[model samples]
Target: MPGESVEYVVVHPDTPVGPVVGLFLLARSLEDAEEIGATVCGRALRTRAELSGFLLLGCEGRLVGPYFDRLLGWAPAGRVMPRPDHDSGNPFLDF
Candidate 1:
């Protein structure tokens, strides 16, 4: 949260309008995080997906969002799917 901090809470687009759930993104540039958040939220809208977190571009870590109860038939994504070029520790991700 220090070092050029940008703290924000973003709700997944799939989430219903009620008290929105939020994900936390911390970055050196608020603009950068905002851009990534917008993309993730937008993709969630189109995919109807639920994610616990996301890895930011040019960052070595990830920003975890809210967790929602899955519908009876829902299938979860890779808990910690890494980009081909990303190399970092994400405890939530299974090796």
Candidate 2:
């Protein structure tokens, strides 16, 4: 199960309704992936007061959103993947 990977897309808190812009990461399960996404968004909300809120719009077993679309003109791709030598003590730093 550890070898298996799942891609999850989280909508940006600012645009929870549409335009779907947020972070994405690969994890072993939906829960882990969602937690990581939430953690990142949480930190963003804490440091950047501009953020309206944090929310998990949706998640799937495969990648989603306009990650590779040139016409969409979305921000540069920012994908978080687990490091081989990641520290289990700190999940946030695993990426």
Q: After superposition on all CA atoms, how large is the RMSD of candidate 1?
A: 14.3
Q: Write the per-residue lDDT of candidate 1 for residues 1-95, one digit (tens) a residue.
A: 23423234444546554334344554456566665556655555566644435433232234333442333225444323233222555334345
TM-score per model over all chains: 0.32, 0.37
Give Cα distance to truth, residue 8, candidate 2, Å: 11
> lDDT tens digits, residues 1-95, model 2?
24324243345435546545444556766677766666655556677766666444553334454554533454334433434433556434432
CA lDDT of every candidate: 0.44, 0.50
**Candidate 1 lDDT score relative to the true structure:** 0.44
Model 2 spans > 4 angstroms off: 1-19, 52-95
